[model samples]
Target: MNRRTLLTGLASLPVLPLFSGFTLAADSPLSAQPPTRLAHPPSYWRDKVSAEAWKVLFEEATERPGSSPLDQFYEPGNYLCAACYLPLFRSEDKYDSGTGWPSFTQPIEGALGTKLDFRLLWPRTEYHCARCGGHQGHVFNDGPAPLGKRWCNNGVALRFVPADQPLPPLRG
Candidate 1:
């Protein structure tokens, strides 16, 4: 099938809903409700993150594949938005897709928002942090069963907090 045909087929599939019984540990960064949206402008994050990270988070630039250490990282932790420190994904949902990026089957419920991107001359679902609106990455249909989602994320746009470490407070 052509790329467009494949994407169209994927788009027609039903998205799995978040589990009603799923719960994070009391100490985990995520809460049952969606994260509170931040009002800060993209410029507000200018000084908080490195230049490369700022590019990915605010400018919506994609990092080189296989360049992110997070792709190989399999530690138990939560991935937070590098721009605003909002928890975006849990370790349990992460997996290696051999795509050279940190891929997840799904994100923390309500942690991200999506929009259609056409920068590559085709439609793709681009997701960003729901709280800070920092661009994370594109979501594809080629993933493991149950969800069939591949949340291919930019490592520069995320900060991994090992389970042993307390999640940092949300930043502007």
Candidate 2:
């Protein structure tokens, strides 16, 4: 289908509300109630992201490998969902796997998730937003140890937040 047709179809889909890190007992960053309502997507969001972006950010579509700006953005910053701004990964957690995507050794504690992705039609592990349920990427056991988890994220799926903002208060 054409890009606009694809985006329009996605925009009509409900935004599956997800919770933040602290809400879940295991710190699932994507735990809000699934979107049960459907409406036209917000104008700002529609304007901010392109139709292609909407597909990846909202529809969980993965881009062809080695084609995302985020895959090369190795700056020290926070990688957040471009759609919801929920913190997903930190620079320190990133690793170079030459997977043509930005690979993280870990996510922001609870900012990721995994499920069976049949896209490749091989039951690969699919990972995504713990909050908005946006598709980030996948995970693989073939990673450096200590965490031994590979969080492969799509470039357009994230917006990097430099460590400019003051840290939030500890949640004790």
Candidate 3:
């Protein structure tokens, strides 16, 4: 009808595709992304994890930068969720991001899930262990070549198993 109305409608068309797979709930800012369910109960995890691991994984607290020795730890091994023992990152993918945290170029296939984080008033892709839904870290674009994805992780949340050792069986 009106020129202004027509222009507004056209501009909005591009945004519709961005929301294609996500639905806004009636009462929350949360997208269609649902909370990842874990096989073990909260009590089970609480009993299994250290207080620091519990803070980072379940409470979503970030460890102090350079606090984890895992950042300098380069042994061939798998990085697993401290709470559930799920293998999340490979030693090969891990690198010296110099960000004071353990960094990986990518996660093991099918081992991670991501959601938006708005803590700093900016949106960031926060990823978690797909199996136990434990918060591992945020993935950023600043990383070495190839994938260029910096999966910055909290050392408190990860348990590294050296190549010489066998990974513990996955917890249900």
Q: Please write out the lDDT profile of model 2 over residues 1-172, one tens digit for every residue.
A: 6878867865664343333311222323334343222233434355656777678866778888999777767777788877666677888888788889989877776566556555753445667665555677777778887766677888888878778775432111
Local error of candidate 2 at 70, Å? 2.4
Candidate 1 structure, TM-score to reference: 0.81
lDDT of each: 0.82, 0.65, 0.76
Better-scoring candidate (TM-score), 1 or 2: 1
Which of 1 and 3 is the better model by lDDT?
Answer: 1
Q: Could you say which candidate leads in lDDT?
A: 1
TM-score of 2: 0.68
Best first by lDDT, ranked: 1, 3, 2
In candidate 3, position 86 carries an lDDT of: 79
Top candidate by TM-score: 1
lDDT of 1 by residue, 1-172 (tens): 6988968976884453333212222222334666666778889999999999999998999999999999999999999999888888999999999999999988887687766676875667777887888899988889998878888999999999999999998886
User: Can you tell me which runs of candidate 2 are displaced by over 4 Å?
Assistant: 1-48, 166-172
Model 1 backbone overlap count: 0
Q: Write the per-residue lDDT of candidate 3 for residues 25-128, one digit (tens) a residue.
A: 22212234433446664567887889899888877889999999999998898999898787888999899988899998877765666666769744567777
